[model samples]
Target: MWRLKTHMLVHTNEFNYSCGYCPYRSRSRSSLQIHERTHTGDRPYQCVQCHATFSSASNLASHRRSHLPPVFSCDVCQRGFKFKQSLL
Candidate 1:
């Protein structure tokens, strides 16, 4: 989901950032670094409340919000969410 849209258009050779695990490769170093997190049990972002960890800061933030009561809910499914964007 994190892979760039441009990656679909560009070839692997053009984007030399290859993954050590599989055939997965990315053009940006940040993309590669984030991808590598899947193989390495490295979770820099940690939730202070539960001590749960996440590879990305955004994911960590999302998990942190889960601990809180829902501020927003989906009109169709009535699913509650803490963030307004989560509803969208």
Candidate 2:
């Protein structure tokens, strides 16, 4: 219903949300806000365990993984890896 209508905007090239700082346009308001951060240099999402900050929550989440224990370990070098693909 409502969700499908929003998704269909991509096919129609109807990016109504325009950035005030740049020529970038987004289908959603949240996406536009994230893009605006590039112009403002606003890094509000801070890591609790570190001084690292990011403009977006997703970036902060990925950074948070550094504080976690590695899930996989290399058999040859005995080195640790957070992602299984990294081990291979």
Candidate 2 lDDT by residue in tens digits, 3-48: 9988888799788899997789999998999999999999999998
Give the least accurate 10-residue stretch of model 2, judged by summed lDDT: 5-14
- Computed on alpha carbons, the lDDT of every model, listed in order, comes to 0.84, 0.91
- Among residues 3 or more apart in sequence or in different chains, the pairs in candidate 1 whose N, CA or C atoms overlap within 3 Å are none
* TM-score list, all predictions: 0.66, 0.79
Model 2 stretches astray by more than 4 angstroms: 74-78, 84-88
Shift in Å, residue 79, candidate 1: 7.4
Error of 2 at 65 (Å): 0.5
Q: State, as a TM-score between 0 and 1, how close model 1 is to the true structure.
A: 0.66
Q: Model 1: C-alpha RMSD to truth?
A: 5.6
Question: How high is the lDDT of residue 38 in model 2?
Answer: 95
Cα lDDT tens digits, model 1, 27-75, are 7788889889999978898899999989998898779878998988898
The RMSD of every model to the true structure, in order and in angstroms, is 5.6, 2.2
Query: How many residue pairs clash (N, CA or C atoms closer than 3 angstroms) in each of the candidate models, in the order given?
Result: 0, 0
